[model samples]
Target: MLLAAALLAAAALLARGLARIEGELARAAAAGNRPARVEFVVPEGSSARRGVPPRLAELGGGRALLGTPEGELVVLRRDPTSGELELERVYRLERDPERHLRREGAPLHGWFLTDVERERRTALREAWERYQSALAQALEDFGASLPTAEEAAAEVARRGGADRLLALTGPEASALQRRTAAIGLARAGYAGALPALLVLLRDHQRNAGFFARLCALTEELSGLALDPARPAEALAEAEAWLRAHPVRDPYARKGAASAGPVSPPR
Candidate 1:
């Protein structure tokens, strides 16, 4: 009798676990199915069980569901207020190497709802787009190779390019863009903008020699004294440059790679 009772108890525990899994699956489908830990893109109004694109996973499939190596699903939908597609939800999945969900396998084979990292790249996308658009506009306005190209480019700067680049250098920008903006400013003869690049390091405790090698790179472009020694003066120069001119893509210069070779400060 005791042996029979123990077997019954085991079966009861298994049934409860399966029920919990079923509930979780229902929730995942309703929430928009996708694995939370894996970085995958899912379109709005699609079923995760069907299949979705995986960044670097070998695709696998089972009788019940499609799977990636990591096992999960993602969903994206347009925000009504913003009218932009945002990452709507992510669902969990069993780490099945087969890369497919097995519905017949009962409750253990599919998605769960647990992830903390916000799955969205909207801000990064927008930032990169704006930077590219501005560069393109500036280059178009400058129209390289004209006999008076310098004058034209300088005029574009005064109209607004210079001030715009400086504006992007503010703390509001991501470190990547800020570095690019500062380098552009330096190449445009605004040595003062080098200061903006320095601040991105986020390490106030670093000594002088370390900073000089870093800023030394841009010092070549501006032709002005970029002494990290006197930050007050550098800032003043930056402000003055900001007031006077904007950014221009000096494509006339030989060997200018898109945004120049400026790396972000470490």
Candidate 2:
């Protein structure tokens, strides 16, 4: 009798868990189906040779639905007073030839309706991840091109600040490479990477001689002098300066100089 009671309790718990899971899934689905924040959409007309022309149907009460031949359903809801048409939702329908036609009364144009934002966010995330991987690979390549620690120190001692980082060790080369990358990032409008670059600037693993070059690079880009040894304080100061004087993307500016090798601070 105890064993049977215990089994019944286990089953009840299992059922409750399943009910909770179902509720969570339902909530998730509802959230996923929420209306998309649309930018502007231009009508892309289709020729007879190109296939079926695009369809635009009014759902009454200042609400219009546009069915693109490419299986995109856009719901546009206009303001009652202002008459400004705002995009309510964007859904990618499953490929159904019959449903693509103008139907009298249909729940939806297709069987499955996938939210555009979810798909877009997923794709953007994947692309961003790929970009991060590429950036890491580029950094590794830069590091590979550098000389050994002993060689870099000797080179720095001989040439000082005027000398190009020609034969530096891996650690030393990384510092110069990071400086160059940081400069490039600043020029390219990747201000988000500033913190990472600042961390790299103060890394103890890098040769001490490379700090001046890194500091010089930051000063050149941001007009804020960074003490290479005290990266934490330097980063805070740099951040404050950046908040006041934002780094504008030179590339985006008209008649800006083309990107090239970033020279270290002399």
Candidate 3:
């Protein structure tokens, strides 16, 4: 009788360990996908659902539920158009288990400065100053010989200068350089610079301040002699990119919120 009891206990423990391992595997697979949508729910005094999408559903082998270390629920899914897995929505599991079970990935939070708080502020400050200096130099070089507005605009179009400006800087310095270059190009009436400027605007990992700068540059550029219809389309593309790949600084949790479904490319 004692032997039987021990065996039973051992079996139960094995089963529990297997279950835990399975749950972790499921979460890992889901996190790997980083889907556009996810839903989650938190039960009272328990872990919240991390929200995995259905595309990752296969990994769970039809088991619809998983738990986080904190006991949060998770669901996963695949995008219909791209067939890419994403987390769609999330909710509190205790309040509505059924709904939470069905929830998908939510709009992920953007990266904030707080996420990188441990970094030396002085280092970051110095880096930023250096970036500004490089940007200033690029702008000056690009516009150096043009004596008149028309000549400057013509020069920007002929040089394919935005690419050159971007090449001159590192990723850390690219944002400032891009923005300044865009402004300079726009001021000179360089409609050709719009495509490259648009690319920078759509980048997800760029800091919020940089996005604001892009917006300002876009507005300034839009006022130029270029075709007015294109800027709207350009802005829309940038917004779409942001929604699909929401930027988050690993160190900072703050990032730009999605503006919602982008208008289909016209």
Give the true-structure RMSD of model 1. 23.0
Order by lDDT, highest first = 2, 1, 3
Model 2 residue 95 CA deviation in Å: 4.2
How well does candidate 1 match the true structure in TM-score terms? 0.25
Q: Report residue 263 deviation for candidate 3 (angstroms).
A: 29
Ranking by TM-score: 2, 1, 3
TM-score of 2: 0.33
Better of 1 and 3 by lDDT: 1
RMSD (Å) per prediction:
23.0, 21.1, 23.2
**True-vs-predicted CA distance for residue 197, candidate 1, Å:** 2.9
Q: Each prediction's TM-score against the native?
A: 0.25, 0.33, 0.22
Instruction: Write the residue-wise lDDT of candidate 1 on 1-266 in tens digits.
Output: 22235446666764653343334444444455543233334333334426644432211110012234355554444344653434445655544434335444544544344442332244334444555655555456552322133222233333336565667678897544465565555444554454564463233214454345334543454333556675556545544543453324332121121222332123
Clashes of each: 15, 3, 51
Candidate 3 Cα lDDT to native:
0.39
